[model samples]
Target: MAEKVLMKGNEAIAEAAIAAGCRHYFGYPITPQTEIAAYMAKRMPKIGGVFLQAESEVSAVNMVIGAASAGVRVMTSSSSPGISLKSEGLSYMAGCDLPALIVNVQRGGPGLGGIQPSQSDYFQATRGGGHGDYHMLVLAPNSVQEMAQLTIQGFALAEKYRMPCMLLADGTMGQMMEPVELPDSAPEMAEKPWALTGTGLSRKHNIINSLSLTPDELERWNIDRYARYAKVEADEVMYEEYLTEDADVCVVGYGIAARVARNAVNAARAKGIKAGMFRPITLWPFPKAALNKLATTCRAFISVELSMGQLIEDVELAIRCSRPVTLCNRTGGMIPSPEQVLASIEEAAAKLN
Candidate 1:
């Protein structure tokens, strides 16, 4: 067994990306996620990797596109506002069907809100963020271990589907410290035949671009890309169900919110409230099937979030509004306490009677 080491969540993500065979990292430092760039800067050179801090988030993400075009394992990290600047690059990567890892360690909201933790970017992440008909695989990690584990998984899933992947974590998850077991070996990378490597007169030249002049041609490309997304939806939906065998009230959450919900569920359970927790690990390919199934048995649901009721919308959509869903959330970098969630759970239980 690999020995566990105590490390901050941001550092774990950096180390895990390295373990996943990422050799190129281009990012600009931002609050809550700067540790990722700092770690990469100090360690990338010693391990024959490249870590370049660009002048701006826009420049860094464009650099990611360049590296990905060469069919190399590449990554970039940023916070909420920084991610906004990279939205254009994200769309271009999706249009080109380029695979790369992007990390968003979220902080407070709409415009340079605050440096405190927030899940306000949930919609931005799961909705593809930029202009286009596309989606990126979004992974939410609650713990330092998951922060590391999901980084490796994000790289594999992105390469498999030939699209960008985002690690959506909150400021708390980025700054929190915990024990994690790093990968024992580096992962094997996939071959990219379409890469823009020189032909050496051995074959036809390769082209990597997102441009399509014809409207019908662009339509077909979007359709085909969605077909691949459907496959991912079918095969890659990941989530966790806790103490839900006969739960009457279900609490839904993800990332740091899920961590808090777990504690609330425990408290409710001790009080004989029969509460359970459902946590989505993959926000894009949401565990819709699983959540819909839970709706059949659970009478009501409470969405715990660090945003103003963002995750609740998905819960309602997943269950098709069959069961009553309520929101228990805090915005502007505020977090819901266990006692608060317990009160919501109790209220839900009472209403079911």
Candidate 2:
């Protein structure tokens, strides 16, 4: 049996990235996620890995782009605003078809809102924060264990798709401690013939760039990238369904909000409300087909989130408006309590009768 160690979510992500054969980490410090940088700084030197705290978030992400272009497992972490700073670099990586891991341990924000946890970055993450027709694989971890597990998975997925992956966590998950079993060995990485390694006078040199002055060429690149995204959408949708077999009302959430919604699901059950919980593990390439299928049986959905009705939009779209969806949320660093979510579920139930 694998031994379990107690770790905070941020620390778990750092350790897991190292275990996943990530030898390069470049990031700037920010509230709610600085522990990730601190952990990497302490461990990387001993293992012959590189951990450089860049001067700014912009520089950190561009550093990731450089490492990723050379075909290495690289990662960077920050909070909401820091992620926004990295958005252009993210688009560049996507345009260049380079793979790397980006972590966002979210804090409140449109503009440095607060240092407390918030999921308001849903639109930012899933919609590709930068100006481009591209997408990043976004994984939301609900617990410290998932934090570690998803970090490893994010690296693998990024490499496989040749694009960026974001681990979308919030402050509560970043600071919370739990027992977690980490992997003992790193997974084998795929060869990157497309990487810009020096030719050494043996073959043609590889070039990595996102610029295409020709309109037709740029259009083709966008179309091709989206084709890859279509494959990802088809194959990589991950979600969790709980007590949904006979549910009339479904509670939808992700990350920290999902954790609270699970408790509310149990409470709603006790109160004779057929409420189940649907947690989206992947925010992008969302489990639309699964939710649409559930809409056939479930009469309504309650989207519980730490943002003001952001996740509810996706819920309604997923169900194709076949069923009504309500939002139960708190924004600006406040979390919705289990009782609050349960009240929303009860309200949905009452309306169904």
Candidate 3:
């Protein structure tokens, strides 16, 4: 039986991770996401799991790497600046092909910008934050409900692909309260044949390292990883479309901004305007095909965001510049209102008329 519970997104993420059998969590407390660490600190010990408050984000990510290398499901989380610190570790995990979950409850900034919701980390996440060519299977949630769902999915995808997966959220999604049904079909984690959990049969010792001294070997490794990434792109694109049939205007966004765009779409529909929403759930895989299809039907596309038009570039590229793509956004902890989005939609509709 599935139980319905009202929870903040952060609480739901922690609870869902526990239910998914995550036994280790290491993180440093940060704004809009501290509740996750706090929740785990209180609950992990009771459940016979490990929770450590590391000294810094770098240390926290390294701790997760250590736990994951031991063949256990492990995780850590942070906001923008902290995520920046964890980039080195993230690349290490990706390079070594460690299965771990990382959550970014995004806030504004290139620096310690603000403790408000922002999608400024889109490029950082999709581009693989640190260095080297790698990608984190990134999931974006439009609601608190989806936030819980994606956290669990992040772990699954990470383990399945032997890569780090990220739950890319924002302060709005993290703090919003919503009713969610926990997953009923939780699978038991399979034995990790590759994990270095002190192999009993010492046929050969194991090592997990991101460093490659030789150029030829490193090039081959990069090629192999890109092959894996290609498979991921082909197999993993998730998104949602609302009233897209014969639409004249398409609103593209994710997380909190996407939810606001939903309302704006409905309002525009009420006014007899053909409006729709194209929300990307997997931010890295980024529903390009859907956006292209919508571009064929809609006269214009509006890339609504909580940051200054970061996702707008992707939307334009996906549609191949066949139609005009406009940007509607706010920055530095400010949330664009539904009315404001509706006005943007109205303006776009006028451009078509």
Q: Which pairs of residues collide in candidate 3?
A: none
Model 3 worst lDDT run, 10 consecutive residues: 184-193
TM-score of each: 0.99, 0.98, 0.97
The local lDDT score (0 to 100) that residue 336 gets in candidate 3 is: 89
Model 3 misplacement above 4 A? none
Report lDDT per candidate. 0.94, 0.94, 0.90
Q: Write the per-residue lDDT of candidate 2 for residues 1-353, one digit (tens) a residue.
A: 54999999999999999999999999999999999999999999999999999999999999999999999999999999999999999999999999999999999988989999999999999998998899999999999999999999999999999999999999999999999999988877878999988888999989899999899999999999999999999999999999998999999999999989999999999988899999999999899999999999999999999988788888999999999899999988899999999999999999999
Clashes of each: 0, 0, 0
Comparing 1 and 3 by TM-score, which wins?
1
Candidate 1, residue 320: how far the Cα is off, in Å: 0.4
For model 1, residues 1-353, the per-residue Cα lDDT tens digits are 54988999999999999998898999999998999999999999999999999999999999999999999999999999999999999999999999999999999988999999999999999997899999999999999999999999999999999999999998999999999999877667778998888899999999888999999999999999999999999999999999888999999999998888999999999998899999999999999999999998999999999998788899999999999999999888889999999999999999989
Position 140, candidate 3: lDDT: 92
